[model samples]
Target: MTDHHPDPAAPQPGAAAPQSACPADWDPLASQRRPEDPPLDVLLSGTVFFDIVFTGLDRLPEPGEELWSKGLGSSPGGIANLAVAAARLGLRTGLVAGFGDDAYADWMWHTMSEEEGIDLSASKRFPDFHSALTCSIAAQGDRAMVTHGHDSPEPMSRLVQHAPAARAAVVDLAGETDWWGRFTSGDTKVFADIGFDETGRWDPADLAPLAHCHAFTPNAVEAMNYTRTESPDRAVRAIAELVPLAVVTDGVDGSYAIDQTTGEEAFCPAVPVTAIDTTGAGDVFAAALVLGTLAEWPLEQRLKFGSLCSALAVQQFGGSLAAPGWGDIVDWWGSLSTAAQAGDLRAGYTRGPYMFLDDIVPDHPVQGRRRAQGTFAMRSDAGHH
Candidate 1:
């Protein structure tokens, strides 16, 4: 794909490298389509978890110690983070997930389908099953989490028959094999993510899904641990050999990605922001990455946009609600000085053999540039910060 974002001032030795063209009929802000909806921009499949988060912890608690938190909020989490993020960014997004008949499931379905405008026609509500639960304890820049729930045998788990058609899908590398075949119809793209192997398995066989994926994203730790590499750069390079694109996100430091197809690489510097809770920042990043790719953006723009999205999510509480929309992005953009908006914000990991990035904040020419409109509509009734 050709880079939608071009830097006129820079000297790109081989910027002449071929890139894919933008999608023929994609529009960022057209009216949202409903049932028998047009093909979706992105589709996601994973178990939906009800997230309960606690913040303001001085340190992790001892086994016998009681802990008190200064903040608390709950929302649908797990892959729901990506779903909401994609919807808020104005992608025609859909999800194939499973839930239970309990109140938690009802709330999740309502929040996703009604509030966030995500398509869940392919989702299932299990009468006998209970939705998954995640307890997040956030401190410093990272969070520790514990999850509990049994696997749902519902149809959503088996995605081959239930998943809706979309241009791309975000799925776990360990997910069912059939999903790999089901979603990649015509020109569909598959973006793969990974889950931790508690058993220390980290088996190569787990990477089977990569065979069908166009890109793979993993956190620094997950990337290093899975690839047995010492750093995120080496891991990304190693994984790129398996797929057309590879990215490894290092929290606070920034992120790195390589498009083997175009021989284009970028190491984006994270925008400086005070983080409140980082429970689902990775999911937010992945969602934004999916959006940038669907828009056929330059590799640098894609990474920078993902970093900004993840940074914004960390500033808010709750999982899905924390995912920022176009309004939030524009609001942040409006806060920057003209130079900051037009020049590169060099505040993150910098060592690499790739081109330096300028225009860390992208332009908003086609969409209305009203700074006041940056307040996202998906915010809660209280207008959560």
Candidate 2:
């Protein structure tokens, strides 16, 4: 068993230089095109199972090399991690993924069933396949992971068919070719989160089925790979041409989005926090983005919420342990604002309407203020009234 340990240098709330920004405009209904909520009921499909994560360790062994982990335990892996993050944030969630007949799978089932707002009727037991496992090695709060999938395509398809009513369906593109069409054709809003292989690569054609998906969450590296562009802005624009909503996250540099309607680019700054293990940080960000969309918090707020969730996610060792609840996120945001206000850093800082954190973090403090006001002006003119 590998032991997982959190990085000692990971930033605690008061430890690092606090990131401060003006609170985004609290517009509760800024992006509600429809009268009804998008879909609070979330169906999480794709890979699911216990992840045997190891932290405070090094690379996977070669032919023969001893490695020690500071901790070891099981938590939801892949798409399930997003589900857990959403559920913790008080969304009604369900799972449509395959599990194995192993003891680890049993634990996964039991834990997910007991989660406050998650429904697991769609989870299946695959006898031939063991539960998925991910072993992570943490160095300076960054992680390297090795994962194994024990299930085949056939069983995964069956599990997906059993999903209950869901407002949106989040699919981890773990090589699920057939599932995309089915979900998109259904009443569910589709969100695809693509995973990266050891080569740090994936094919853009893999996302073709999800062309009209409600949202696509890709990290900066994946965005570059998908669009074959060195510039994140160009990558986002390229992706938005394919999908209506393209969210590209760049670790500490921040994130950007391409608006499908007007072909505009929106950037948000990374919530400044000392990261510990950025293992499931992106997953957590994706989950929050989807949830915020469901709530119609406007594009800017949705991205900020995601940034806040991700910032909190990297403070711990494992993915699930680091995931923060809604209250914790609010506190973090509030703390950021408080810190910013207390320091002399507020020179020329204009607290415009609250936008996503990614928008403000990358620019000079004064520039961010100007950008925030400009965003509000554009939104006002763009029929967000």
Candidate 3:
């Protein structure tokens, strides 16, 4: 497992002068696309969970009563969803995670590293430990899940040790602050989100990461709790003071964001979709946020794109596998025409991102066997093998 240990040289926020803008040298690819020289656009660190999902069940199983699910499938879940979401959106994404060399881990790692095009150069493997597992059951409009696993051998903060200089990083709020400083020192945009606080403490210190994060996205409750504010707008304002851009997402009411750069705020209603399962919607929401910010689009446009993406994600069964890609977005837009708009927001939102559609080539490997089974071994704990 990747160690959560801090890198001795990891820069601390405010310890040095702000990272300078683009350096003197100039290569079109290096200067513009990869400002940080990171081989990938985003390098993420989180736990990898093997998910077993059961869908299409009309109701939850009664105590000891037999139940039949209409569908059953499996996929890589947990923070893996964020990595897959970014990759599907055309971002060169990498993930630093830990894995046990069990059957579930083998399949999950192969599916993510091979099928998804995510760079797992910083990931580590423990042949003896049992990989994490999540069993999810979907019934009616809701779902229940139970996860089993031990903590990763290392904390997620250690990813910076092995990852290249990425333009942005997706991380949790309570995670290591040192990585935030190190990443930002190279002009890497750190996008941070907070986890649920069952204790309801919602410490203001949790927002400490915002000091280094280029953007901070928290759900309505998380934002409100952290800010001690009642409304999403207030929460956004309080947070905007700390970060360049602050977003507070409210389920059906929509999402609110304040762009400190422009002093502009915007809100977009959630796309009303017959949700099948909302397992990975939040992660999908964060993915759109990352892209919209990177593309320098308007706050309203970013919110709309995120809303649509999350709305689409829940319409499928599995977690990360349910993430919608550009292909899915275009298809959903095409389907909207027949629905006659009906206030579902069919236009404007798709134009900016959709314009680049022609450039992406579908991931269809022509010849049989894209790589060898031993290919997973190519990645060494020594870093970026």
Candidate 4:
């Protein structure tokens, strides 16, 4: 596809490359579609935030002090992060959430439905309400966020009287359970994650939702806290007893998984990269893991794919926009392969983890995709930055 985001101020090369007018779509589950299957591959529901990220900050401003940032990006965040990640990877994603009748809401609605191809049929827009907004500061290898907004007038559980059928649903364990029962009933699989417990209760009873879930993905700290285990490996194993599949993500070191349903256990190392911003890396990882699960890939392969996707996401800024498309994956693999062939030992070692993509990625050239505008500036005004 033609770059949706073009840098006009940059000097043009002597010979510009031809752009793809018609971006080719690569559906990883194209072979599995049936006439009776659900129209949506994945269903998601949560709050949507208009995220403004400030990067290149030496540090956050001190009290009553001011600082300048070198970079800025704007995009839809929260549930939109997972939605964009899944949609970019070719999943027929449907989102159910609340929105406001404001400019931020308008931009986000357009970006997700028109640009990202996410279905918003089940979502609603409330007049007179302001959309949630978050300002994030990235510095010193981590980020901090300040948000402002009220809860949706209507809870998602109440808004979703009847959840539509889907192959899979991604949900948080802390949400209401009334609507979840109807959605998790038949062939639909539920993948659950949990938020940090601010109360420090770390109570196992809070995780009762796992009884109905097919898989659970949690960070290493979350797993250890809930399972009372000291290490990620033990935490995953403990969690596997509750859900058929358990995945614990350990930043930098990688991820660990235990799939009791398939009788498999494995660990996948993280792909090393200089992270520019890590806004929605977990959402990307969850999306990739869901894709692998639906495609019936082995446990280890799924972890590796998820880790690779997360790695790519952290290299960019815009939370939802940072999600990588198939073209990004293909380009990354091609570049690594070329480097390895040219005697780059590091590329060779790094490529060994994703060798499985050889059989899965499409052989034909597909469109390359990246994040949208770094800022919400008009196209003609973008060059000023």
Candidate 5:
């Protein structure tokens, strides 16, 4: 069997790698196709909780100034949102993380174990730690967040010790890095999503353990931070050196991917849509990409599915609330594709108008517009600063 390898050196943009029309003798697909449903076992192994979002009508008040909320509510957040999105897409999902001994934790567990199809057997209950939460101020559908909580790191040995059947593990790097080394040594496919906190940012060094990951999905800012590069193309190139596949999402600017196996890069243009709330757009994209890959869809199709899912997420406030199920996404994709063909480029779909406590703020600026469109662009415009 011949080993598949990618060029270690960077290829000039637009330069094509040599192509092979036929599969090698040792290609995994050399055997006959199996007639079984694609395995749905996926572990969303990381932070879990509800986000307590508070949105205001205008810019946040000065330190001593009091302000009223336009809206407020609690919803699933962090890896919990990712897991729910995966479950909604028909994956047999599980979560491996810690939750507090608070009412929010109860809500989180019930939602995962009862309302959703996720297995919560591995979740550790901590009595002292606060359940993760995020508070946001909304202006014209865009939001600024203030979040708190510490994600307890689960040991890789403990995770592997449970030994449930799974095809892949989605790691949200909000926990300890040591477990990463152990997690990646197994044969299961590995994918990672980055998270940030108030006093710290996700360090690229933490990703070194996942040197041969099946895929790395990072929004443009995270990608730039990982690569230490100013240019998006350069960041993509740098990340390809560490992982087999790297996807860099730049909001409305679209997304790009580098195939480590072939040293080929593909671009997925963002589906043009008006967005209401921009939360959870990246998580939705990650879940959709995983589903598409599991379905063996082509690379471009996988990105298209992911991008469409993200578009739907921004149409509403909060992360998980805005996520569309697989069926809804398929329908939306069909409509978008048809619209694209007809040159009605601006027609798109969104998922939410869900009410929140913060929506009560008097004179709030986001009353009628979607936030995802311009907010992410503005937030990421600095490109990793």
Candidate 6:
């Protein structure tokens, strides 16, 4: 793994410097819209956590040693990572999760519903429940986290019952949630993901939910262990037998995917970028894949898009908020194309792989999107307390 961290002298919150303002809004799906289509593009339900991320750590502290991290950030995490990622990519996203009445919950609610423009019509606020919180120690492109929170007072089935209809939904098969069946019944395509099995059992029954899913995305290790395959290629093929679309993401090596729906299989290489923090790179990848799939793009392009988005995400710090918007995509492509034209060998190879993006990215100017903040203070509450 690449050993890299943010510069210690950088800003405290989010660790990275402030990003430029991105376009207020841009809908990539406008061209494919139909009058009868669902109001939301993606539906998600899970716990939302107030994440406190510490970056620039040289190493984990020894038992008796104390270490001061050079960077810090605060944002909504857990399911919110996927939610913000999809929304930033111009998907009309809705979230069904429980929230608390505390300050942390209030900040996350404002960030997701107001700042991020995610739909929270189905989410509920408990009277005194405290919002979930995670403290992430980031170093060497990976992280260790300590989280404190409780399960939603109400079952996810209860919250999802009121969720808006959508074209697709992202489900964690590990959650063993029963609501995806209801979604599939309504013609919503389900994209499933599985969490690491700490039990090491790697039981096949854990994947029973794939029967209702349109696609399944798992990391290389998880896929290999679950399928008992020797390699990601074999794992993806085996997984495809269970779900129409099987995606195995190998960090830095890129992603491999097989789409039985399109009779296409492809491997997209990871875009090389200096590592900062890889907190939510996987979520970013899944969001990009969902966008490409919903748009009816070719399977190869879908993998490539997902790889590129995740690459962009890891170049920054934080999780949910670090996800790139279209403006970020535009900037990355523009820089690459310029470098390629100027005879940069590596840039040429990278730009050529994503040549498909030439036709899809917006040609006109677009605003830069929101960046991760160090604090949860909302402008509306400013000067009031």
Worst 10 residues of 1 by lDDT: 16-25
Please write out the lDDT profile of model 5 over residues 176-278, one tens digit for every residue: 5444454466666778766544455556677765575788887788778767789777887887877887888898988888877655677877866777667
| Model 6 misplaced regions, further than 4 Å | 1-24, 380-385
On the 0 to 100 scale, the lDDT of residue 240 in model 2 is: 83
**Model 6 lDDT tens row, 43-77:** 99999999999999988776898799998888899
Clashes of each: 5, 16, 4, 0, 15, 6
CA deviation > 4 Å runs, candidate 2: 1-40, 57-73, 126-129, 141-149, 152-154, 197-204, 262-264, 334-385
Q: What is the lDDT of every predicted structure here?
A: 0.68, 0.59, 0.69, 0.81, 0.59, 0.82
- Give the best candidate by lDDT: 6
Stretch of 10 with least lDDT, candidate 5: 17-26
User: What is the alpha-carbon lDDT of model 1 when measured against the actual structure?
Assistant: 0.68
lDDT of 3 by residue, 194-297 (tens): 88998888889767657767888899999998999999999998989999988989987899999988777998888877887788899999988887777777
- Give each prediction's root-mean-square deviation over alpha carbons: 10.1, 13.1, 9.8, 6.3, 15.3, 7.0
Model 6 residue 302 lDDT score: 90
> Which regions in candidate 3 have their CA more than 4 angstroms from the true location?
1-37, 176-181, 337-385
**lDDT, residue 177, candidate 2:** 56
What's each prediction's TM-score?
A: 0.77, 0.72, 0.79, 0.91, 0.70, 0.91
- Candidate 4 residue-wise lDDT at 283: 95
Model 1 regions lying over 4 Å from their true place: 1-38, 140-144, 155-160, 338-385
lDDT value, candidate 2, whole model: 0.59
Model 3 clashing residue pairs (backbone): 2-154, 3-154, 4-155, 38-165
lDDT of 2 by residue, 178-274 (tens): 6546667666778877767566556667777666587777888878887899988888888887877888888899899976744556788987777
Mind giving the per-residue lDDT tens digits that candidate 4 earns over 1-385?
A: 3223422222121111111111225688888778888877888999999999988888877789888898888899999999989987877787888899998887787667655667677788899999999999888987788999988888787766644567998998886556567666678889999988999989999888898999999999999999999999999999999999999999898999999888999998899899998888999999999999999999999999999999989988888889988777888888999999999999999888789999988777654454546656322221122
Error of 6 at 286 (Å): 0.4
